[model samples]
Target chain A: MSDKKISKIKIGIINLKTNNLYSIYNAIKNIGYNVSIVETNTKYLNYDFLILPGVGSYAKGMKNITENNFNKRLIDFILPGEKKILGICLGMQLLFENSNEFKMTKGLGLIKGKVKKFKFIQKTIIPHIGWNSVVLNNKMNYFKSSLINKKFYFVHSYVCEPADINYCGTKTFYGNKYFCSSIIQKNIIGTQFHPEKSGKAGINLLKSLLK
Target chain B: MRFIRIIPKLDIKNGQLIKGINLEGLRVLGNPFEFAKNYYESGADEILYLDNVATLYGTNNLSKFVSKTVKNIFIPVTVGGGIRNIKDVEMMLSSGADRICINSSAIDDINIIKKTSRIYGSSTICSIIEVVKIKNKYLITKSNGRDIVNKDPLEWAKKLEQFGTGEIILTCVNHEGLRNGFDIPLINKISRNIKVPVIAHGGAGNFQQVLEVIKKTKISGVAIASLFHYGLVPKFKFKKNRIGNFNYLDRVKNLNIKHTNNLKKLKLFLKSNNINVR
Candidate 1:
């Protein structure tokens, strides 16, 4: 007989993206935790844990969340801190108070940071493309290696600046040394670099997060 | 840093290399093999082929075409157009082509990306993205810009990355054959969103435009068709500052996502299996 009541870990995901999150969906599936896309299945936000993924501008993500009635529900989900929440990219910024992306928009404010735009690294580039070393800020989880080492994929013109060092977990270089590549404040976890985009390391990181 | 590649695209149709007014050339250019040879000798890292008729005709039999081109050149080759199955993937790899680009198929069935990447390895699964200038934003297209998928290129790109796609070939349909400039906004956004290598194509009117697109997007590869046609200008005229490509991005991903497992055990298993794919 199949194990139907085998105490399955519930995962609710908010795919606040215009595209698919199947990479993460498949990665998490490999670990045996059945996860569902919350946006598609309206009950996604109510799961034991949730993942917030945003793929475009901060303004668009924020607008979509609010316009779709996802913001209030999301706030309610995290207010208790009983459930583990992970944010990727613009999702990570959304965990902060506000973002300076296209316009000054209010974020979820679960963490005390505001996303800011990058100054000209003109000769270098605008979007900080490719992998760069992430300097651990002292609270990075799933980081078994040294902080100064380990490159991850980062793609953003704006970055999150946490008000307190307690929330900032890693930082990378571009034009300005902005903070909040990865952040953790209790059950709330956020990563500016897409672990999903990071290949084997990304898959492994997702495995660790599930645990 | 690995040498950043400069690529030029030559879309094939009925055996003739074609470019149009927007993808519009108003006529057939020449043999793709001739262009491929010229590009390879001129230092193009690789070449991309979009079968303009694949979606229209519903078959991607570029294996024969690829084999012929490979016979004449010595470098990686990427083929796109009606690629929808594993058999099609094998055809390209067996013919010595390094990668395959999927558009309509990928959107219709995301599993095509996962299955192909799983079997052939993600390195050979390139996705051809045709971004159209729609309502002040970009949308993806298929079959000579007939059907448009409302999905944002950035969002689709990230999802493809998750599916273990090897690379992204971002062709701005709005800019294709226009020779005005590379779609800087689309290039920047998509490159930022997807972690794998991105090759920006279409609208490279000059070598300076090539340098400018690379500097702006930091794409792993900058592709041009017009730049080659304009002249075989050798040295890069843009600023010397190097931007990070997917090579470094892979490093960051290595640390963050792979979980904190027993390093010795994982390394030992990998070494013993001889499964190194880097």
Candidate 2:
């Protein structure tokens, strides 16, 4: 913790050309951090934190990652350091091993998990869009103590299912299914919901990352 | 389950906020970004802006406004009106709108819904279903109530659900701006027939009217324009006086709609009534 504070903190937001690119940039800037918008062509990985924000299907999102070689650059950037990465919405799905959206698409595999669509009975709505509270899995006492169950804006039909239960950071319920809303594995953190869009609670999450 | 969303509907025309009765008699309201931020601070769950004249403009003219507001407001924003094809949807989404509402375009080509839902994901798309009651039967209408489709709304809703629409905005054209109340029977029928969440829109005279509609229907949210647009000026109390009646031009100035009855009171009212609100 002391060393983390001693080193100068640099935040880089990878530009995936998602819908919320500029909004995320402004939100982080408003939070009092001098953030950098790293374009796809640039290979600058000298940041303490990286945010991968995306919206749209897994196939298209993964295609952008592969076409632009963002996957290779991202993996190389965080492999040998105390650096952390945060993935929001479709960005979170991209961190998993593979996804079943549209077709079987491979993810970054930073965390061992599979992305699957929400399955429920006939009356249950797909895309579980809106503000839903997420419960911190008690297995991780750090999250349990700091981030109790709180509501966050979620707009997705797909969620991450980590291979190991220990990787599950937070869980949420939609319809009759309880799925992993977030994953915390060492320095990598991913949230199925958009923290930048979740208002105060969301801001708090981003601020926590800064600390 | 999560709380029901309370969305403030801002109708935009020619890059200015406007309000009207039954989607007619357009009256300027205020700046779109200011109103959106005020609503967000007051605890609005989400914001919806419909480009009232997007069809005539042949573009989502509200993209700049959406981008500007998304910087200050952290809540999700949905933009609608004149979304004709995949490119239009892409433009709006890329402009910082969390979701895109398709009405006239989806009605024109059902395949547009399929194509968008496939690429942008179902959650990114919301289908706005505006209906007009004709001889006790609810029929789907498009182009801002100018064109009526000879198809059952329930059938259309099912088709949209199958096409993977994230949700449905059921707006009653007759009840819109009339302030009578929501079309309860119409909302109930559509909400029950579809699997996706329904956003009950139009004809919300007060919090009570919203609660009444929520109580009977399976809607996941309520979208209000006149209720929020008119601010806290009581409906009958102001009209009864007739002393401060102003025309369309001075309506935004003369009326105290800007600073009156905010999102906080509305949320409290809904919560007090046992309606789950964010």
Number of the top DockQ candidate: 2
Summed backbone clashes in each candidate are 24, 0
Candidate 1's C-alpha runs over 4 A off are: A1-7, A17-19, A40-44, A146-148, A176-178, B1-278
For B189-263, candidate 2 gives per-residue lDDT tens digits of 999888888999989987788889888888999998877866733221222222211365355445544457556
**What's the i-RMS for candidate 1 in angstroms?**
13.2
**Overall lDDT per candidate, in order of appearance:** 0.66, 0.82
| DockQ of each model vs. true complex | 0.02, 0.71
Give the C-alpha miss distance for residue A88 in model 1, angstroms. Answer: 0.6
> Across residues A131-157, which tens digit of lDDT does each residue of candidate 2 receive?
887887747544453356567899998
Quote each prediction's TM-score.
0.50, 0.92
Give stretches of model 2 more than 4 Å off.
A1-8, A139-146, B232-259
Task: Please give the TM-score that candidate 1 achieves against the real structure.
Answer: 0.50
Give the Cα error of residue A74 in candidate 2, in Å.
Answer: 1.1
- DockQ measured for candidate 1: 0.02
